[model samples]
Target: MTDKKMNFEVSKYDSEIAYLSFPAHPGKGKKGIVMKQKELSSLIEGYKGPEVYLDFDENGELIGMEILL
Candidate 1:
């Protein structure tokens, strides 16, 4: 994925996740997931600086999410 600010639901919330456009239907919308306030803060805190973007790859094993600085 590109380093664009995509939407994702934190797994901690209600045990459900929604992606923008979503995996079920790729490129179907302008924005897939809508981030909640807490999730947005957590993501921002990981940056520890100015707001930017992050990108990651799909690990062959388990699904992975990171707050990498």
Candidate 2:
């Protein structure tokens, strides 16, 4: 399921998408970027939150995002 989870643009290779928890600064939003699907899981590893989420388009563009907490 392509749920809502903030991701980042680390790198890419083939069908793998390297994503991270929308790298956010102190009291600020995250630096979102387009990422592949394969990278999504590893990026979200070892994180605590109310819930995980993501926002993107079929064309691989960051449209919107959110965090359960």
Candidate with top lDDT is: 2
Across residues 1-69, which tens digit of lDDT does each residue of candidate 1 receive? Answer: 644344455445544433332232223333523232123345555545432222222332212232312
Q: What lDDT score belongs to each candidate, Candidate 1 first?
A: 0.34, 0.41
Candidates in order, TM-scores: namely: 0.18, 0.33
Candidate 2: where are CA atoms >4 Å away? Answer: 1-42
Model 2, total clashes = 6
Residue 33 shift from truth in candidate 1, angstroms: 18
Q: Which pairs clash inside model 2?
A: 4-53, 4-54, 5-53, 5-54, 17-36, 17-39
Which pairs of residues collide in candidate 1?
20-32, 20-33, 21-32
The true-versus-predicted C-alpha distance at residue 24 of model 2, in Å, is 18
Worst 10 residues of 2 by lDDT: 19-28
